[model samples]
Target: MKSTMLSMLVTLLLIYLSVCLVVFLLQRKLLYFPTPPLLHFSPPMEATKVSFENGGERLSGWVVNEGRAKALLYYGGNAENIEYNITFFKDNLPDYTIYLIAYRGYGDSTGEPTEAHLYSDALHIFDQVTAEHSQLSLLGRSLGSGVATYVATHREVDKLVLVTPFDSTANVARSVYWMFPVSLLITDKYESAKRAPNIVAKTTIIYAENDNVIPRESTERLIEAFSHRLENSILIRSADHNDISEFPEYAVRLKRALN
Candidate 1:
């Protein structure tokens, strides 16, 4: 009886270890869900295709209303098709040129996605647009918020808007997978809270009142990290993680912040 009990315990231990190993090895695949190149709403005739080389990788995206002195650079969610935003920007923010960035592995951009690569690409995009535009604002949603926060800390941004933001991806993962040590296992720790203090740009965070992905506590923690900058954070009362953009109030608040 004692020997059978010992064998059972040993088997369970090995199974747990194997599970942890798999999770650690394929973590990025779980974190980043890159959508296939978008077919619908390809860059409209009014927009220009912008492509640049970063570390030998070709990155591309659409630049709408390209000649304006004021611009908005957008970094989208993990699986977002950024081209969908062109019509929204064309109709509402006609005054400023908008650059919807296609993160590596998403859309036509070459190479795979990683936190370091995303940050590098974002900086390159910002620098390329800076020559044409006098003032630049940043908008990042979900996973892009981490990339946007990193850029805002390093660059001179006029305004910073984060949608469905989190304090840190590690913390968010830990909350979801409480049995594992996700903080230690996560390679792309987009710790936005850590970089918040370095950002001096006028910042606004938009969160869904009923967010089912990122916990309200996580969003609140990110808001707190901004300290005095918390004055501008807005919550869409009837929205969820992915559908916040559908709300009229969300667009109205975004226009107010960007303008």
Candidate 2:
């Protein structure tokens, strides 16, 4: 009877360890759902294709209203098709040029996505394009919020908007994978809270009331990190993480912030 009990304990231990190993190895895979570019996704608007070399690889995206005096650089969600916003910006935001691009391994960009790579590429692209526009605003949604926060901290951003933002990827992962040691296992710990205090840009944050993907607590934590009062912190009623932007109030608030 003693031997059987010991054997059962050993088996359970091994199984738990095996599960942990799987979670560690596949963390990024579960986090990033990169959507491939559509070849025939030509919207009925005029947009200039922008391509540049970063670390010997080509990075590409679309620029609408290219010669405008101001620019808004948009960073989208994990599984977002950025081209979907082309017509909206072309019509609604005539005051500023819009820059929408995919991260590496997403859309038509080359290479793979990583926290380090995304941060590096965002800053590089911002520097390259800043010369063309007098002022630059940044808007990041979901996972892209981390990338946007990183840029705002490092660069001189005129305005910063974080939609469905989180305090840190580690904390968010811990909330989801509470059974495992997610903090130690997570590689891309986009620690926006740590960088928030450093950003002096006029900041606006909008979050969904029913964001199951990123808990309400996470967005609240991010809001707390900011030193000053946020220009606007509107909560979209009845909106979820994926569908927040679809709501009329979401666009209305965004237009007000940028304008």
List TM-scores for all candidates, in order: 0.96, 0.96
Tens digits of per-residue lDDT, candidate 2, 175-227, equal: 87899888878999999989988888899999999998998888998998895
Off by over 4 Å in 2: 227-229
Q: Give lDDT tens digits, candidate 1, residues 123-202.
A: 98889779888899999999999999999999999999999999999999988888988877899999999999889999
Q: In candidate 2, where is summed lDDT lowest over 10 consecutive residues?
A: 43-52
lDDT of each: 0.90, 0.90
- lDDT, candidate 1, equals 0.90
